[model samples]
Target: MKSSVIKIALILLGSYLIGCQQRPHADKLQNATTKKIIGYIAGWKGVDTSAVQAEKLTHVNYAFANVIDGMVTEGEGRFDQDKVNIQKLHSLKSRNPDLKILISIGGWTWSKGFSDAVLTDDSRKKFTDSAIAYLIRHDLDGLDFDWEYPGMQGDGNVFRAEDKENFVLMLKSVRQALDSLEKVTGKHYLNTIASAGFKSYLEVNDLGQAQQYLDFINIMTYDFVGPGTDTTAHHTNLFNPNLNGRSAAQAVFDHVEAGVPIEKLVMGMAFYGKSWKSVRPGNNGLYQPAVWNSTHPYRNIQGMVGQDGYVRYWDEDSKAPFLWNQSDSIFLSYEDPESIAAKAEFIKTHNLGGAMFWEYHEDSDDGELLNALFQSLRK
Candidate 1:
C-alpha cells in the first residue's frame, strides 16, 4: 500500500510540473499590462508630430535604414531627412518618456542586400557591428530588421536554400553582439524582426530556434491580398471564417504551433487600405475579380467613407470592414476603430504580445485607431 501511494504522489507531482511549464511567467503579465503599441515611422515622408498621440504608443520604429556592403547606413541623399526625423522622434520623449525608438533596417524595397549581407559569419558580424554603431550614433533604443524574407524571392532579392540555416546563425550572431553592447552601455537593447505573415516564410526559417535570440517577432499581417490577386479578399482580417486560411488569427496560430511562444508574437495592423476598381457588383463586391486601384491611406479612406462613390460595408465572416461602391464597381478593404477593437480583444484573449502598425502618419489627428487599441487593451 505504501509503494502504490508513493507512485501516485510522484505522478501528481509530475503533472503539476508539466502544467507549470506551460503557464505564463509573471513578467509576461506585467508586460502585457501596457501591451506594446508599436508604430512604424516613415522617415522618407513628411511627418506631423502634432497629429501623433505620443502617450498612446510604447515604441516608434523609424523605417528604412539602408544596408550597404554588409553595413547599416543612410540611404543616398537621405542623411538630412534621417537626422531630422531621428531628432523629431527623440523630442517626443518629453511627452512620453518611456517611448522606445528603434531604427528599422531593410524594407520591401531595400531588402535585396540582406541575402549577401548575412550569408557568412564574417558578413553577419560586420552587419551587426554597423547596426550597433548606427543605433548609438542616432541615439536610438534598438534595431529592427525588416528583411522581407531569408530564403524566398522578395522584390528582386537574391535567395539560396542555404539561407534557411544561415538566417538562424545570423540572428544568433546579432543577439550576441547586442548582448555585448548591452553589457557596455548598461542598457537593454531590443532585437526584433519584421516576419512574413504566411506559411511560405514560416516553412523556410526555424522560428522556434530563432525565437531564443530575439525579443519579439512583428508579423506583417497585411498585404495578404494585394493588387496581384485575381479576387478581392480581406487583406488584413482578424478571422478567416471562409476557411481561406488568410487571416491574422491564423497566422498567430501558425506561429504559436511552430514553437514561438504566444507572448512574443505581435499582431500587425495596417493603417492604410487597398482599393480595387471594376469589381463585380454582387455579394458586396468581395471575392470578385477587379482592377487594382491605388493604395489609399486611412486619412484618404476616412474622407471617402460616406462620399465619393464609396459606401462602407462590414464583413461578418472576416470580422473586418470593406468599402464597396456599387455605382463605380470599386471595393476597398481596410481597418477602423471597431475592427481594431476586435483585434485588441483577440490579443487579450489569446495572451499575445501586442499590436503593431505599418506607418503612423496615416491616422487622423484624433488618432482614432490608435485610441481604440489603447483603450481596448487597457480596459
Candidate 2:
C-alpha cells in the first residue's frame, strides 16, 4: 500500500511540474533538438485577406492583434466586426488545422479604451463577458491581453494605484472563464499578454501577481526611441546592435528577471522601422506618429524603393537594420528579413520561447521576411 501511494504521488507531482514548467525551461527549450515557438502578428485592417499565407509555419502570431473593445470605442478607434476579419481568421485556422490563432487585444490605440473599461466592475464585466464571447465565436486558440498596462494610463486616461493588483484579478477572472469554456468545448485555450517595456510597469503594478496565471507574455522589445527623439537607435536588436542600452534582446532579459518565467516570455519583433526628418546629429528615436502613418508626413519607408529617398538596407552592426529615404531625408523605422532572422536565431540559440513580430502589413507583400523566419526556424 505504501509503495502504491508513493507511485501515485510521484505521478501527480510530475504532472504538476509539467503544468508549472514555464520557467528555467525557456533557456533549454531549444538545443541541437526540439522545436521553438515562432509566432507572427496578423493585424492591420488594411492587410490582405490572405495574410496567413505563411500558415505552413508552426505557429502564426496574428499581429498588432486587437481586442474587441466593442462599438463604443469604434469611431476613429472603434473596431468593426466585419465578416472579412472573421472569415480570414477562420480561413487561417482551416488552412493550417494545427495553426494557433491568438487574439491579441490592445495595441497603440486599443490601450486607451482599456483605461476606461477597468475602472468599474459593471464595465469590466461588459468587456470581459463580451471578450469571452468573442473568443468563443471566433474560435481563437488563445487570448493575448495587450492592455498596454493597468495602474498606469496613457492617451488621456489617468492611472489608479489599485490597478496594480486589479490587473492580476482581471487575469484571474479571464483564466477561469477560459478554462471553464475549455471544459465544455474540449479544447485547450492559451492565455498570453503583452508586458510593458519599462521595469516600473511591473514593479509598481506587481505583475508577479499575474505572471503565474499567464501561459506566456510578449515583451514589446522595440521602441526605445525614434524620430520624435533627439537621438537615433536600433529599434530591435539581439544585443547591443546599435551599441545602445535598449534593444529587443535586452527587453527579454528584463522580463525574465522580473519573475516572468523565461519560457513564458515571448520576444516582440518589430517588422517596421522608425523614421525622422534628416540624419542630423539631433534626429533619432521611434515616433508614435508612425502607427498612424496617414496623418504623418513620413511615407511608408518599406513601400518606397528605387526612389531617391529613404535609407534602405540592414545595419549589420546594429543587427536590427533600417532605411533612410533621401528625398524628404525622412527617417523610417522597420525591421527586415535579415534582422528578424538574426533575432530568431538568437531566440533559438538562447533557448527562448521563439519570437513574435509587431504586425502584418508592415512586411512586404512578397512575404520575403516571413519566409526568412520560417527558413530560420526550420534549420
What CA root-mean-square deviation does each model show from the true structure?
3.5, 8.0
Candidate 2 residues lying further than 4 Å off, grouped into runs, are 1-47, 56-81, 119-126, 241-244, 281-317, 324-333
lDDT at 307, model 1: 97
lDDT of 1 at 63: 92
lDDT, candidate 2, 1-379, per-residue tens = 9999999999999998986676434544434133334455454454355655646344555544343453122224324543345456667656667767766666656666665565566766676676687677666788777776677665455567877766777677778877888899889888778776766676777656688778877787877665356544555666673333676677777777777767677677766665555444223322222321211211254456446644465556568665555455455556666776787677776666666666555666676666776666545
lDDT of 1 at 348: 76
**lDDT by residue (tens digit), candidate 1, 34-151:** 6889999898885567777888899999998988888999888998889888988998889999999999999998888888988888898898889888998898888898987789
Please name the candidate that would achieve the greatest TM-score relative to the true structure: 1
In model 2, which range of ten residues has the least summed lDDT? 290-299
For candidate 1, the lDDT comes to: 0.87
Stretches off by above 4 angstroms in model 1 are: 1-32
* TM-score of each model, paired residue for residue: 0.91, 0.75
Candidate 1 lands at a TM-score of 0.91
Instruction: State residue 345's C-alpha deviation in candidate 1, in Å.
Output: 0.5
| Residue 90 accuracy (lDDT) in model 2 | 60
